[model samples]
Structures are given as structure tokens and as C-alpha cells.
Target: MLELEGIETGYGETRVVHGLDLTVREGTVHALLGRNGVGKSTTLKSVIGQLPVTVGTVRLAGQQISGRLPHDIARLGVAYVPETRDIFGALTVRENLELAGRLAGPGADWTVDRIVAFFPNLAERLNNGGHELSGGEQQMLAVGRALMASPRILMLDEPTEGLAPIIIQQIFGKLKELKASGLTILLVEQNLNFALGLADDISLMGRGQIVWRGDAAALKADDQAHARWLGV
Candidate 1:
């Protein structure tokens, strides 16, 4: 559902992502794994139109979206949840979901009730401000907000970073459920076990390029690749 060919993008003149090529099939979870500075996040930003692609083509569902504006790309059924978990600190939980749903229009599949059902903790804290929630709660809120867009492809950067193990498990479970529901996902993750457990396909990046690509089981068995690039 998503493909990036010869992707070369970076901040200003320094190219961080060098001739990267990737493909995420429909209704599957594809994980991008790499150490710090391998351009995993930059690749995602380039695809989502946050970072400029100096040389490449980004296609979503066979439509070119390389140089489009971020909002315009989002309108084409692409939802990006950055590592920062960008939520409105001043907005109450209910208000945040309401605003996202309103922006998504009436045909969105994700509703406030459904989001709450997926995240029962959010249901009880509907009136709480975003700032009032814990780190895990905030991450849940971020994912919930992205789902509110009713996206065909969900891109997440470091969703499990700094969360408790229990919360991470919960997040993984929700992602599994989303995958089961035929949601295509592109995930940039540092956690090896987490990525290996949930991803159908895995790609390892090094020096802004994809060094290895394989199924999850193949990656699990390739200890040399894991140690060389991922330091695992």
C-alpha cells in the first residue's frame, strides 16, 4: 500500500536518507529497524511530506505524494503519529477526540466511543486535560487521535519508547487488533523484540540505506545482521 523508491531526503544540504527503497504491503505491519542516526524517522517524515524528498518517489496506494503538503497527504488516508506524541495539552480528552473526529468529517470509522472502548482508561478520564495524563496514557491518546482520522495506512515512530512494560504490551495488543482489522502500518521502532513480535516484514537500516529486508522469522534467525546493524 506504501512504497518509497530511491528516497533521498535530509535537513538542508546534508542528506540523511540515501537512496532508500521500501515497500509496505496492504493489510500488514512493516517495521523499520535501525540504530540512532540511521534515518529511519527521516524516511518516515519524507514519506508523510514533513521532510522534503530531494530525490525519490513516495507512492501510497499507487498515487504519487512526494512533494505534497502534510495536510494534503493526510487527507489521502495517511495518518502519522510522530514520536513526540503531539497532543493538545490544554484540550480535555473528550474535546481532543471530538476535534479530531470533526476534522475527519462524519464518515470516519473511529469514533470517541470506539477509541474509549479500545482504551478503557481514556473512558474514565474523558474530562481530563492532555497534560493531566501519564506518559502511557498520553501515548494511547496519540494513537487514538491518529485512528480518529480513519486512515488506510498508519505510520508510527517509536510508539513504545519510555513506556512501562505493561503499557507497551497493551499498545502492542491494540496494534495487533488494528492489523487484524486490515490496517496497513509502517512502524519505525528501536525495540527489537517488540518489532519482531508484531511485524510481518522487517527492514534494517544503516547509514541512511536499507541493509537487510526479510520476514520476521528470518530476521529472528539472522543473529549476525542483528548484531552488526542493530547492536542487538
Candidate 2:
């Protein structure tokens, strides 16, 4: 459902992702795994139009999305949840979600009620400010807010970052539910087991390019691939 072809991106003069090609199919969870500084996040930024694709094009479904403005890309059914989980701290949880809900086009199926149902913990916290929630709660709010936009593909960068084990499991469980419901996801995650459990396809990135691509079972058995590409 999403494709990046020969994309090169960087910060100013410093190059990060170089000629990286990857694709996420419809209704599947594709995990992009890599150690720090491998440009996993950069790839997502490029897709979301937060960073320019210095070389190749990004396509959603079939149309080329390269060089479009961020908001335009978002309106075309791409929702990004950054590693920082950038929820509006001053806004109540309801307000935060409603802000994104306003961006939904006609026939949108995601509403505050649906989001609350999807995230049961959020139901009671709607009146609470973003800052009032714990780290896990904030992350839930971030994902829920993104869903409010009624996106076709949801990209999450390090959804497990900075959370306790229990919370991480909760997040993973919710992601599995989303996957079962056929919401396409492109995930960049550091947690090895978490990624393996959820992704239908796995791509291991090294130095700004995809070095290995395989399914979870193949990766799980290939200890050499794990050690060489993943440092496992």
C-alpha cells in the first residue's frame, strides 16, 4: 500500500537514508528493524513529507506522493505517530482526539466513541489533560489520535520506546487487533521480539538501506542473520 523507491534523504549536508527501497502491502504489518542511527526513522519522515526525498519517489497505493506537503499527504490517508508521541499536552484527551477527527474526510469510520472503544483505558481519561497521563497513557492517546483521521496506513516509529514491559505488551496487543482488522502498518521498532511477533514481513536496515528482508519464522531461525544484521 506504500512504496519508497530509491529514496535518498538527509539533514542539510549530512546524508542518512540512501537509495532505500521498501514496500508495505495492503492489510499487513511490515516492520522495519534496525539499530540506532540506521535511518529507520528517516524513512518514515520522508514518507510523511516531514523530510524531503532527495532522490526517489514515495507512492501511496499507486500515485506518486513525493514532494507533496505534509498535510496533503496526511489527507491522502497517511497517519504518522512519531517516536516522541507528540500529543498536545495542554489539551484534554478528548480535545486531542477531536483535533485529528476534524481532518477526517467524508464516510470516515473512526470517531471519538470508536476510538474510546478501541482503547478502553481512554474512555475514562477523556476529560484528563495529556500531561496528566502516564507514559503508557500518553502513547495510547497518540495512536488513538492518529486513528481519528481515518487513515489507510498508519506508520508508528518506536511505539514501545520508554514504556514499561506491561505497557509495551498492551500496545502490542492493540496493534495486533488493528492488524487483524486489516489496517496497514509500517512500523519502525527497536524491540526485536515485539516486531517479530507482529510483523508479517520484516526488513532489517543497515546504514540507511535495507540489508535483509524475510518473514518472522525465517528470521527467528537465522541466528547468523540476527547477529550480523540485528546484533542479536
Candidate 3:
């Protein structure tokens, strides 16, 4: 379980997220949907300690974590997979995964072998550098690396961005499996169809805060909300 209350954060003094409040219940996938620049990524960054929350509290399982360091937040079982897929380009696929596990300092349920198996495509790419992987493979590596930390809640930003349709389907399937395994996920995605397929609950963000909240069927039926808030 994770909660953000009245969060205000941004780059320098230029605020992007304004009074944003969101919550992810245990063992559920909650999708944060929005157009570009609605602060979906910023909210994730703020929760992970990449950006400081100026006004409001971020709580994970009822423990306040807004002011903590990124590594510290990670140690508390919060893992983040940014849209950039920030893997170490110089390191081999195995090295990239092993490094995260090593930094996590034991007790991680995910191991290098486990990650490789989870992303079967990575099994043969073990000795290849991160730079050598395709976009899909890189995305898988990014998710796999995050899993190495044995996170309680995983936050992903734009996981389906700029990928082939087939690759997106693969990602969707993997996420489905993750959800079935009871891993809590907070997803910031622009792909409405993808989000609807995986999320149990969906929240729409406009400007910088939530404008609508509902399940997939409810979202589909809300033409007014879509037209007004989503410009559909």
C-alpha cells in the first residue's frame, strides 16, 4: 500500500504536480492515466525521492517516506522503472541485474537467474552489454532489474511507450502475470487500452491532479469525462 497526499513537486521551482493525491492498495494494479505533461512521471519521481515534495506527505504502508533518500526509499521495498529504461549501458545484461541485487544487500526474492528466467529473452543476452539490446529487451531488463530489489510496490512510467505492437502485447502479458502473483503496481501510462487491460482501477489526471477515477467498464461508459478531461 502506498499513498500520496496533496503532493506538490517539480523541477527546481517550476511546479508540475499540484495537490496530487493518489493511493495504491495492496496487491492491485492502479493506473494513472494522462496526456503528456500532466505530471504522471513527476508523481512517480516524487514518490521515489528523485524530486522533493514541497507540500504534502508520501506514505508507504502508513510510513512517511517523502523526505527520505532514493536509495533509502528503495530499501523500504519501493522500486521504480522510469520511462527511460535507465539501465547501465556499459554493463552486461547479467551485470546490470546482479548489480541491483548486490546493492539491495540480500533478502531479495529475485535473483539474477530468476530475472533471466522471468525475461526469457535475456537468458541468451547475459553476456551482452545493455547497449546491445533491442528496445523491447531493454524494457524487459529494466523491469527485471527493478524486480531484483524485491520491491513491495513497483512504479512504472510509460512502460509501453515507443514499442512494437507485439512487444507491447508481451509487456501486457508479463504485467498480467505480475498482477496474478499479487505484486502491487502503480502504472503511469498513456496507453488507455493497455492500462484498461491490466488495471483494476484507473485514475485520470488533468493539469496536475486527478480529475476522474473508475474501473475499466466505468471509464468506457463515461464519455463526458473522456471528452471534457481527456479531450477524447
Candidate 4:
């Protein structure tokens, strides 16, 4: 479980996020959705300690982690897959997975073989450099690398960005499977349909604040909520 309250953060005093509050329960997918520049990514950065919170607190399973180092927060069972997919271009797929596992220490759930099994395409490209993979393959590698950390909670920013529709479906399928296996996901997504299909709850952000929050299905059915907050 993760909880954030009244979080204020910015890039060097030019505040981008203002008083944002969010909650993600254990074993559930929580979607944070908003238009561009509304601070979805900034909120995640604050939560993961990539950026310092100017106010309020971030707690994971009741342990405060707001200002901790990103590595420390990661060691506390939080894994982040940024929008850029952050893979090492020169590293082989196997090497990348191994590095992630080593960084996570022992007791990681996703072994290299297991990650390959989950992503058979990755197994096929084991010897290939990250730069040689297609966007979909790169995205899979990103997810696999994060899984190597064996996190209880995974935070993904735009996991489906720039992928083919079929690949997007595949990624969502994998996300569904992870959810069924008891992984708590905090997703910052632009694809509302994909997110709504998987999320247990939805929190819609506007102007760097949560203007709407509710059950995913209910919000999906509420035209007024969509019009007012999502503008779609």
C-alpha cells in the first residue's frame, strides 16, 4: 500500500504539482490520469524520491519515504519504470536483467529465466543490444528489468507509449496477469481505455491536483465526470 498526502513538488521552485493526494491499496491497480502537463509524472517522481516533496508525506506500507534516495526507496519494494524505458543501449538483454537482479539484492521473484519466460520474445533476443530492439521489445525489456527488482509495488509511467496497438494489448495483458498475481500497480497512463480496463480505481488530475477520484467502472460510465475532469 502507498499513500501520499498534500504533496507539493516542482523543478527548482517552479512548482508543477500542488497539494496532490493519492492512495493505492495492496493488490490493486490504481490509475493516475491527466492531460499533458498536469503533473502526473511529477507526482510519481515525488513519490519515488526522484524529486523531493516540498510538503506532505509519502508512505509505503506505513513507512515514510518522501525524501529518501531513489535507490533506497526502490530497495523498500518500489520499482519505477519511467516513460523513457531507461534501458542501457549497449547492454545485452540478459546483462540488463542480471544487473537489475544484482541491484535488487537477493530474494528477487523474477529470475532471468522467468523474465524470459514471461517475455519469450526477450528470450529470443537475449544476445541482442538494447538499441537493436524495436519499441515494443524495448518496452518489454523495460518491464522485465523492473520485474528483476522483485518489487511489491510497481510504478509505470506511460507503459504503452509509442507501441503498436497489438503490442499495447499484449502489455495490458501482462499487466492483468501481474495484477492477478498480487502485484500492486500505480500507473500513470494517457490511454484511458487501457487504464480503465485494468485499474481498480481511477484518480483524474487537473491543474496539478486530483479533481476526480472514484471506482474505475463507475467513472468510466459517468459522462459528466469524464467531461469535467478528463475533457474527453
Clashing pairs in 4: none
Residue pairs of candidate 2 with colliding backbone atoms: none
lDDT of 4 at 132: 95
* Model 1, span 79-167: residue lDDT tens: 88899998999999988888776547567899999999999989988999999999999999999998898988999999999999999
Superposed model 2: Cα runs more than 4 Å off: none
| lDDT of all predictions | 0.91, 0.94, 0.92, 0.92
Worst 10 residues of 3 by lDDT: 99-108
Q: Which candidate is the best by TM-score?
A: 2
The digit string of per-residue lDDT tens for model 3 on 211-231 reads: 999999999999888787777
* Residue-wise C-alpha lDDT for candidate 4, range 127-196, written one tens digit per residue: 9999999999999999999999999899999999999999999999999999999999999998888999
Clashes of 3: 0
Question: Model 1: clashing residue pairs?
Answer: none
Cα lDDT, model 4, residue 72: 91
lDDT of 4: 0.92
After superposing candidate 1, which stretches have Cα over 4 Å from the reference?
A: 103-105
lDDT of 4 at 193: 89
